[model samples]
Target: MTQTHPSPAADTGPGQWNPRLWGLLLVLAGNMLIDALEVSVAVVALPSIATDLSLPLTDVQWVMTGFAVGFGALLLFGARMVSLLGRRRVYLAALLGFAAASVLSAFAQEPGLLIATRLVKGFCAALTAPTGLAIISTAFPQGRARSRAVSVYTLFGAGGFTAGLLLSGWLTEHTWRLALAFPAPIVLLLFALGLRLIPNENSTTAGTPPTGHRSYDIAGALTFTLALLTLVYGITALPEHGLGHPLAAGPLAAAVLLLGLFTLIERTVSHPLVSLRPLRSGALVRSALGAACLNGSYLGMLFVLTYQMQTVAGWSPLKTALALVPAAAPPAIAALASGRLVARFGAPRLIAAGAACAFTGYLLQLRPSWPLDYPGRLLPTLLLVGAGFVLSFAALNMQATSQLPPAERGAGSGLYQTAVQLAAVVAVALVAALLAGAEHAAGPAAATSAGRPALTLVAVLGGLGLLTALTALARPTTPTPSVPRT
Candidate 1:
């Protein structure tokens, strides 16, 4: 909620550090890193968490799913939350809430309690993540300086997953609780700095909608939330009960109906939660699809690889985590350079090339040839995937928001992130389902056999994403709307 705008006198010259600007950037980037950490940290620790809590793997998967559900479900209204509460208030409150949830998770004795805490943390993230970016937009002067700041900020975000992987690998060695507890202190530190450096809202723009008047669409929010929750529930249950089973079919059917109703509500409402007008933009549609596919395939692929490394390859947690270091870390550098890369090759080209790289990586990783060839097979694939992520992720984000008017940028970002979170949930669930189905087909070799098909599906997703990016590239380009001066 800090509303600090950069002063004209602020020097953001390359190689010259402005103390105030750097401090502000640190605070913002640090918080962004925390959000990113929460995402990847728990993923690596899931096996440990399940063992400690006496839960099945299916149930442990919900710790990650819960976060995705909470994040995706509420993000549709994040802009509304900002408008109603004021940005600084929501940012600070969500930070506090996130810290509290982390603490609760650290102490949780029951699986249900731990999952609930993750949900709270994720909901808090929905509130904080967009606000952090908004703060950066306000705090930094537009043009090259802002671009540099954003690239740095995003680079930190990319690095966070790697940091989390390394940290969780070490922390989970003693107890998974330490990994859960790690963020609380970091959040508190950021909160204290935020209190001092975060600027107060200008009286003119404080506590008011942009166009003088706009109302929150409560009905639309409720319906959309329910629809997403139902959808996730159905998909998550698919592994337990086949798709045709009543438990799975019922929720899936209801989700479709609820989503239909939500769309109708959006169309009818005077001040809709989302502006349906933007939905018609084919560029935005394809960009969002590209993001979903990229995340879905990447995360699902990681899930299977993690299992293969641990259970089949007989590697320790530390060794497994270290093996993935190449995939997790190099993307930070790639993200920083992506802006220039996009300028030369264009976002669509980068996206297509990135997806192709990811697909190739998956193909290389296919089947692993019995005695697990780490150096010959896995290392090269990891590097390829890492390079692909660096290329695609930032470019897709730029493309998604490129066509939006300034006023709707926040909502556009929320929508794009919503696609990411929802896709992650879907990816995990589908992979779970594939693995389960493979068990019946493979019998004695279920553990090893299950991974091949799951990985093949991941490769298919990568190919589909590549095709979508190419389709977008083939279309005529629309001129991006200019941001009007304040």
Candidate 2:
């Protein structure tokens, strides 16, 4: 069947270069930045949150995990909501909800209460995030404009992470709540602007349903969240209290059981939150797996690098964050360049090459010595890792997004986002567990001596990820006409 592509909407532009187009980009990117900011801002604020609530480091981490699991839970529903409520309405509603949640996070007197507020914040993120990319797809059809819009959209994400680090450092220095409260003001400001700037159209991605009564699968949504929360809580609790401990096994098994049930339910339910079919797309499957390793190693590196710099090399927190600047660059540049790169070199090869560069950087950075090795060992590795990341992230995103049909974009993207988030969460726990155990056995001087093993674990993870990227190399340069999204 020759699937007829939707023509550019009635409002499509050419050389006109309307500010609204740029504004549209901001709306999408801004939504993503909120998610990114929630993570980074809270990092700097952790000490403050802990101190205020008199909680342990383990408990405080939930302030983040709560939000993350929440976001991932509802992310699939995000696409559906856009169809039902209209993208613009959903987007605005998300902003308002996010703003409200931020206030709650800022003012919460109890740790559990803060975690609950974070859950709400996470749901708002899920509602808001998918539409950002979906909006870009419509505002700029998949060509030069999309290439640029994707670049801008992705840049906001990378840039937001960087900004979050910097802002977190500064804001937390004065008041942790300020960091949480900051985006509230920004979101409100953007809310006013978005109201004026966002296109009046509901179908951000063309050719879907033109405003109908889209059903909300409350049962599917609730069950999926329960399963994920159970799993994440279980997995996360393991490092602190070993796998055999009740704190770990109980939740973990329940999560496994619940999630298995969730899968069974998805197969039977209409409008499932996530359909399993996307898992069969060889390109998407590999892309997602490869990206997972990339993210895991990336976060792990950030962890190791921060520890080496601050505890061993005498670098300040600000300086440690600044050191990560290079790792964040390539995605910005490549996202803009993706259209040309894909048009010429093809997506699979580009993904392969990107993974190779990242892998190379990891190998070089893995020194047998320690933090005191400083510029001789650390600087070069950090720079290479940064360079490798810059070259890859955007192209990887373009490749993945390009392979999926438009209607499935939301669910597919939510899956991608979930994978990325899960990788980061898992990396933090597993890497920390390994390093902490190693450090304990090695003693205080281990920081300067045996950190190499931690680095190698990260490198090995990256290498495995690189191998997955090779799968793309075998994929045909052209894709079959996509089915409506997963």
lDDT: which candidate is best?
1
Clashing pairs in 2: 330-390, 408-485
The candidate that achieves the highest TM-score relative to the unseen native structure = 1
Candidate 1 versus the native: TM-score? 0.89
Candidate 2 residue lDDT tens string, 269-366: 76677866666556566767777788778777766665566545656556655666556544544544545655566666766777787788788775
lDDT for every model?
0.77, 0.68
lDDT tens digits, residues 106-140, model 1?
A: 99998878988988888888888777777777666
Spell out the clash pairs found in candidate 1.
Answer: 1-87, 1-88
Off by over 4 Å in 1: 1-19, 142-145, 203-214, 405-408, 440-445, 477-486
The RMSD of every model to the true structure, in order and in angstroms, is: 3.8, 5.7
